[model samples]
Target: MSEEELNARHAEKMKKKKAARDKILATKTIEKGLLIVHTGKGKGKSTAAFGLVFRALGNGLKVGVVQFVKGKWETGERKILEHFPEQVTMTAMGDGFTWETQDRQRDIEAAKAAWERAKAMIMDEEHQMVLLDEMNIVLRYDYLDIADVIEFLKTKPADKHVIVTGRNAKDELIELADLVTEMEMVKHPFRAGVKAQKGIEF
Candidate 1:
């Protein structure tokens, strides 16, 4: 086959695959939400959560993102997310980081505010997916009520998908999660005295 013919054949194959997936999904008729937790001592929790965001967006789903304790917008994801303000909404806690905040009480207040935003998103069924960035650490730091958060999440709209990402996800959160991934840090460049790099690690 010619190159163009091969390309057309590949496109047709993909179309068939998508059609099959749609058929199976329609037959199942499972109308419910998903609770996902990404946590551990390792890394990429937020990255994993954002990957879900991209997937949801690809499927034409609206997403709400609230970043707990990430006060700034210098990261690569932030830059891309900003371009899609209509499809993706984001709010960041005003504290630079946990250790840099200095004022513990004030940091807690910031985290609480971020949680409030996430709370609203969880309750809003209009949003197909809600991403609570680093919220696990916020709850672990005692900045928000774990019980309240879990209750809100559990009662979320049937089709809503909630993603919570951070280190040290509480036991209650883990129990509530239908899907959970714990990223254990086996080895990192930081251990070898390498600093965080742009585009790749971030």
Candidate 2:
């Protein structure tokens, strides 16, 4: 085809695409809090949730974060977010991973304590966004009662958004979530014997 013909054809196709996108956009008028789940074996689950925290803060929104399984080490995000103490509430509640703790009872206790903090954040009207980091792992191990968690989630205020991140999310939670993203692992450096580098893994 000639260059002029190609340009005209592309313009017509783009015009149609824009019209369809606009139509769809026009139909989306509903607005409410979302129950967002980020789970899977891949990396970046908590990273993605923290990105939303930054976006929310940028919009003058208050965010509450409770770390369930990553409390042993210091993270760069935590340090930066601490600077915005007025808008961000971050609590590192876990004692570390299950393997590191090596005690089922200790893990359970930690999970329970973390859940108490998370529940308070969920119910606090001051927080617009609450990130429950690594919550899925606790759920997978049955640390907290799923039914109780569901009840509180369903009763949260209409304008409070909740983000739960970790791997191996339960099916019940997935069913109740408004948006669920399962990150599929295509490749990872850990499998190649590469230890986690600073500012990337944390």
What value does the lDDT take at residue 154 in candidate 1?
73
Worst lDDT 10-window in candidate 2? 71-80
What 10-residue stretch in candidate 1 is worst by lDDT? 67-76
lDDT of 1 by residue, 22-69 (tens): 999889876678899999988788888998998887778899999886
Off by over 4 Å in 1: 1-29, 71-74
C-alpha lDDT values of all predictions: 0.84, 0.89
Candidate number with greatest TM-score: 2
lDDT of 1: 0.84
Question: Scored by Cα lDDT, where does model 2 land?
Answer: 0.89
Candidate 2, clashing residue pairs? none
- Model 2, which residues run further than 4 Å from truth? 71-74
lDDT string, candidate 2, 1-202, tens digits:
9999999999999999999999999999999999999999987898889899999998999999998887534478878797788999888765686888889998898889989998899898889999999999898889999888998899988889999999999988899999999998999988899987787776
Residue 55, model 1, lDDT: 82
